[model samples]
Target chain A: MKYTILFGARSYEHEISIVSAVVLKDILKERIQYFIFIDSKGDFYLIPQDKMNAKTFSTGGYEKYPKLQMTKGGFLQKSFLKEQFLGVEVMLNLIHGSEGEEGIISSLCEFYHIPYIGPRIEASVMSFSKELTKLYAQSRGVKMLPYHILDKQTRNIDSIPFEFPFIVKPLHLGSSIGIQIIRDKKEMNYNLDVAFEFDNKVLIEPFIGGIKEYNLAGCKVKKQGEEHWIFSMIEEPKKGELLDFNKKYLDFSRTEKTTQAEIDTKWTERMQMAFKALYHHCFEGALIRCDFFIHKDAIYLNEINPIPGSLAHYLFSDSFVSVLDALAQRLPIAHSPQVRYLFLSEIQYAKGK
Target chain B: MKYTILFGARSYEHEISIVSAVVLKDILKERIQYFIFIDSKGDFYLIPQDKMNAKTFSTGGYEKYPKLQMTKGGFLQKSFLKEQFLGVEVMLNLIHGSEGEEGIISSLCEFYHIPYIGPRIEASVMSFSKELTKLYAQSRGVKMLPYHILDKQTRNIDSIPFEFPFIVKPLHLGSSIGIQIIRDKKEMNYNLDVAFEFDNKVLIEPFIGGIKEYNLAGCKVKKQGEEHWIFSMIEEPKKGELLDFNKKYLDFSRTEKTTQAEIDTKWTERMQMAFKALYHHCFEGALIRCDFFIHKDAIYLNEINPIPGSLAHYLFSDSFVSVLDALAQRLPIAHSPQVRYLFLSEIQYAKGK
Candidate 1:
């Protein structure tokens, strides 16, 4: 079956997506017939080897090349996109922000009636928006910092209810882009300017002080031949100040201390409950990495990466589920003949008499 | 500036979109330059007249249309899209339901860096999802019907803690599609099946015994080159049995009984406050139609349509504001020189070395 790995979108995390797709290609090589790559520039290519080289075609630039382009009048140039998947069975999505996480691909998959693994469009959109996610999380009793939203038209910054030392970021951005820790009113103006550059809406939250951060990566893998799914291990960053983007991604040369942390059984259980609630609330599937800050023995959810980096393979230790097993377990069933028939019928009916 | 009118999508309200785009074309003909039409089959065409003519496009059938061809590597062609919106400046979206209302187009607009007139992506998605909208409305003290979400994997439908005589619908569908009023277990099975067809998630709400429907159409209009915006008139649908899809759209032939109803001025004041709260909460602009049912003199919000049918132009009557004037007020502001420079600089930075 032909396998496609969609990556590198028009988002701040586009590079991260490329890195993720490369890593995933290595892991899924033998399991799938062929891997197709899509990059941030709206290009599609094929991964020739373990180390995929990005290239450009007349249609677009892609790593693992695919011949397809959405043309001027909304016409599908069949010759370009109708490549038999060479038994291509599934799409491994490595897109991070924007259209990737917010359900564009999901809707396209639905429209094309293809089986893709990830959160449905609704959940992805809700989770992608910090305001929406915070609202849902707060309603579900998930711990979050008290925050207020400010629009571009907002005139009086003095009226902001939150106290100083607040953190501000674009309401709909990821990868900590446009994040600013405003220490006073002097910095507020500068920070707001930076935040507004990324988006029209800005979110200001009172900074949570003095808390250790942890990355809990897990795949909601349905047990082999079973209906039940289980959460994987929890990885704690070496105790220190918050790791910025550079430390997290670019500074990989430095052996940043990360180890499996010892969590209290009760705390682990609570985290599991929160994770499950989030999974159900967001209707997310496959791998997810949830970040949380521990303050006074209580865990506060920072954010969720529906399409986590490296497919969060590192989190699944040798003892637990492997990447291959996790992928196999989470792979969605292709559209049944009955479902396909219904879709075709709807399309025909829509054509009108 | 080039202008494109994006209409006709994979929605149940595809025909309604065509009607909307045609009407909008008639109104904006003198105001804008060029108008490109997007048909229901996802093909683009030019609407020669200011009215929709099914005979012109429908005669050829969707598949036989000039643009209907699959590409080589399986991606839709882009030449057709470019030709359709060659000189388009802004997209006046008339698409309704699911992908349209759920933020796919908005996201694409953002990706392409094109300006559009409607609710932004996040708000659109939230407003359409019944469970999320209800939760948000409840949070804002907006009275709403009590409803519970029934997930697909859940067992024991009887365990849901809700009263009988419930109305069930797909969580994120619009136009009253797949909506069913179930009175007992015998009906529950059938309604659930119907709802599940539209979406994987379903919302069940206890039917509000007494129903008096009202349609409040208002737009945030700039008052004569001023910075402040004002809301337009609020029109109440003539009180009667709930208007179904057939009565609302299909039977426009019937004389519309909707007239501005007399009510205490205080009601208008309160409703305005509610509308403003929602506008700020969702960061919405342009026209919005708020549906409400008064039970025991208490207004309970059913839902909000960011892009209501006919742009809810009927509600603007009696008010000094005309639909054309209201639309003119929303014309996109060309970026200031400084702002444009900043935008270009940021894009260059994003382009990276």
Candidate 2:
């Protein structure tokens, strides 16, 4: 089966997506048939194997490749003579933020009926917004840190439940681009202004100093008729006041192996249970990483990476192809709407009579 | 200001979408530059003005038209020699049910940077599933009928809170496609099976026999800098048991005047207020209809039609072009993620130094 590596959409993490795609080329190897890149301007390109390097994209060398067109089943690349189908039987969504996690690729894949390894539309939509993610977590009986969503129109800072020092994050961003630690009331407005520049809404929560954050990546695979989860070893990321954009850039671009965090077995089981509660029926086909904060001996969801950087493959030991194969066979089928139009035809028949 | 009318898709209401598109051709007249149809098979076609009729789609005559390819900014049509851009500045989403209301067109339009008149992804996601819609209503302080969601895995019927003669509806479907009223426990299993055939999840609500249902369609348009709503007259659709797919078939095909429903002005205001609460910050840039059931003097939200058939033009006397023009100008901007990779560059500079 032919696989397509889709990456680099109009996102803040566009460069990170390219890095992930470049890493995937080595991992996917001979199975990849097309390297589809969506530029920051939202144009599609079909990059050759040799042109998969970051320099090719950064230097504008990708312009030499044929521009791809999104058609029914898959993408089409046109030459001087005719159009050719990329024949992508399956797609691996590598774009991290924005279009990748915000339901564009998921919607396109679902509409085109192409089986892909990524969060479905509902999962993507629920996870894209921090406020919505909290709601989803609460709906699934998972604990989340108390937070308040403030938009551009929100004027009452007094309404916030959190006191003195708090953290403000752009509602729909990841990789900690517009996240800021607000120390006092004086810094509140300025930090909110900065966060609002990245997104229309911002999520504010109490800044818990020295909170232990653990990251776990996993996916659910169906075998025969039963489904089970395959979880990766949890890793505790190095942090300061927070892991800002600079620290995350190094984290996003890496493909190296890291040792698993040494944590208690009971905590591990508790975290995995929380992850399962959040993932189970909601995130069926996607490989997702969930960051949890252990504060006051309670696990609270920090955020969900619907398409984690580098697919979070460094954390897992299993072969991605086999897991994706198992998932693809059991993807949630789009509702088969009754297409008979029998009633309409019957009305027409009566009118003719 | 070229406009594209997008209709049809893999939906139960595919025929109704064609009817809606044909009705739009007359109302939109010369403003439309292209009539793009997504067939039941999910293929795209550029239907010419001459072939913009129900017969063209019903008899599969639309195949004679040029096949369209979705490109970066807009759709592209390939001829014998070369491909041509449709140059669509704005689009009106006319497809109903599945692909129309399920975030495909919304995601595509947002991804491609095309200004469109339809529900945005979050709004579509919230309203597409009946369970999510109820949650959204509760979150927004809007009243909704009490319901329980059941999946195929749900074994015990005793878990349901409602009594006999309860309503069973496919969670993700519209137009009453797989909705049934279980008169007793004997019919519950059979109805659940039928509803499950349409969707994996089913929403069960107490059937309020002879409930007075009203539909109100409206849109929020940004005038100058302030956003205000333009609401159509409230409508009372004829219902028998349930407005099944057949009754909705006739209802979906109409392009005529509908009289404003005669009801208490206070009740009408309450319903409109509820609609406002649901649409305000959520469903920006889209024209939507919300169905409400008035039971015992309290207004309860029934469902939201993200893309109402025929655009629900008959409910309003205002010019759609003007309203759409205002909406297109003020469509919610996609989050401009921090594109400057300044942090990454700074890290590289530090390492190089």
Candidate 3:
């Protein structure tokens, strides 16, 4: 039951990833055989800590940690470490945004023949592309907000079908980094420039009014050779007119605000069924989390978080340690790539690594 | 420039891939610096031949070639060889079908920081999933034949909206494998059973009648500082009611029987624009080839070949060797992952030797 814990990339979520990885390492400190931190520049480092807190990354002088090298054997090798977790039984991937979650980490693991927790490359890539998710989900009757795609090549703002107060989002960004509510003509160019800074492709959609957001986290649990999708108690977060990054993280943790609690059995049943349908549509993932907006009793999906922050550990009743252990063992089975598309080994690749 | 020519995989397209690789090896014999081959079981080998013919792979006993290892440096290294492709100026990838074309090879190259040809993982995975491709392309107004998706969980064909004389294709397969033309109610279950063998999900669509097929090859050619997509001579191949694998490869080369030649400049211009739109929507592929149906004077895409067989060399009057050399140089500049995602060092990880 060897484990390799990896996180902290150059993404905007770098700090959040650090916090999650350190907390996860503390929770599963005894079980982990290796802890590797990838810097914003994609450099691998051997963390020299037995226990970590939120401040460890900054205070611990992590830059002093020896830079590690990859071996032909697929192990991240260092001069001092006796166990590198090269051929570990599983990789507990805690990476959040960008390449970390966008199939790069999973692709690396797949290539090296190590089973990884959560989604595989195809699922990660699919989730990373929000428009693709909408198209696939809408086909299965998952209600979604009306949206239009805009890239660098897009010239006409007049062509946008949505009215003002529309939200413009960089297609590939995570969190609310480059999202802006364009209220009028004067606001259009500024928001477009802001979004263009983060991503080449952007998505513009009508901002739903009176939107109440609900977040649900779930896992694919395997038992007795059969699989079941088990969801946790849903949480509704109270938000400002818009949940900006500052409001999301600085004010308080999004987890603490429980504006709405408990999900209806029938609604949960319908959601699990839809998720299973999407899963069967060539995506492989586990411990899935989703955000939805309930406007006038009709649910519109905000996004699917394949690898949620803190792994959404708070949602499950099981101890976070137990969840990590079980996930390390079970995620691979649920993440199996079918022979449907000339099935080959996973290690897909680290995009924009 | 040092060149590494790679191909062959375990997928159903294994033999076709070998034929392609062998032919490519012969065409670029004088220029190739090294040759590598991957077997169906995902094994890699070093090939010594300076030149290879179409017959080489079956008679090559490539298994006898030295088993090679991938270095952390992204070089395909073997002890006996004078040098590995570590930091090769370029890699001419001619792999077809399976992991070879499905972004795995490209991922491997990407992880090693080598810019290989064809679509990146996002596009490859998108193209690999027919349902996803349809959803993405149809949104861009890419006229596609009406189709329905039927997964293993589907209980009844009676529920399908498509009528009889439907073509059932496994969602993930290529090269026409596990495809059946269901002409009647009696033929439905058999074809469903046939397709289910290849993929868990199947696409059922009414077989378009009088479907005249057109195949066009194009590349993401760079001229001046601006990039332009130039297409090859469009070829229309006569079909025997259906262009199954047998009709596609074994009977005769699909290239020879060109029933229609010369693409209307206007049609090619429209197709290129559609392709560029698809590309900007996060697809990164060069040397793109597409199959289409001209019905009612409208274009309908059947599939997009990211790495067309033999790189669709015959379609272009340019020398095949020169195309490979030029592609090796220009592909990387056009393959940047954009700026919004935290910029990380692209050399992420190389797992499992």
Candidate 1 lDDT, tens digit per residue, A1-353?
A: 34467665556666556556656555556655444444444444544554353222112334234344333311132243342333234665677777678776665555454456665666677678888788888767788767887888764687679888888888877767678889887888888998888777888888866766767766555565555545667777653344555445432222223457787777777777787777754554556778887788788888887777756766665533254455444655322211112322343466683
Task: Identify the leading candidate in terms of TM-score.
Answer: 2
Please give the CA lDDT of all the candidate structures.
Answer: 0.61, 0.83, 0.66
Residue B337, candidate 3: C-alpha displacement in angstroms: 9.9
DockQ of each: 0.18, 0.50, 0.19
- Where model 2 places Cα greater than 4 Å from the true spot, the runs are A318-325, A336-338, A350-353, B318-322, B336-353
Question: In lDDT terms, which candidate is top?
Answer: 2
For model 3, what TM-score does chain A reach?
A: 0.84
Better model by TM-score: candidate 1 vs candidate 2: 2
Model 2: native contacts recovered, as a fraction: 0.44
Q: How do all the candidates rank in terms of TM-score, highest first?
A: 2, 3, 1
- Candidate 1 shows a clash count of 50
The weakest ten consecutive residues by lDDT in model 2 chain A span A338-347
- In candidate 1 the C-alpha lDDT for residue A138 amounts to 79
lDDT tens digits, residue span A1-353, model 2 = 66788998888888888878887787768978789998777778999987787567766778888898776678878787977986678788888888999899999888777778899888998999888888888888889999987867865677888887999988888889899999997897888889888877788998888899999988887776777788888999877779888678778767776668999998999999999988876788888999999998899999999899888877875566665566666777666655664544565567673
Give the alpha carbon lDDT tens digit for every residue of B1-353 in model 1.
33456666666666556556655554455655444444544455544443344444344333333342222211122453232224344566667776578776665555444566666666677787888788778767788877777886673597667778888878877767778888888888877888888777888887776676666766555666653445556566643344565545532222233456676777777777676667664644446778876678787888888877756655665442354455444554322211112222333356661
Cα lDDT tens digits, model 3, B1-353, are 56677777656776666556655655556676667777655567777864343433554466676777554434656454254554555676666665755566766666556666777777777777788778878877788888888867654677789777889988877778778998898887877898887777888888877777777776665567566666667777556778687555442222332333666877767666666666654444457678877778787888877777777776765555555555556665322332232211111122111
Compare the candidates by DockQ and give the number of the best one.
Answer: 2
Off by over 4 Å in 3: A41-43, A48-85, A246-283, A319-353, B1-3, B51-73, B76-85, B153-155, B246-281, B319-353
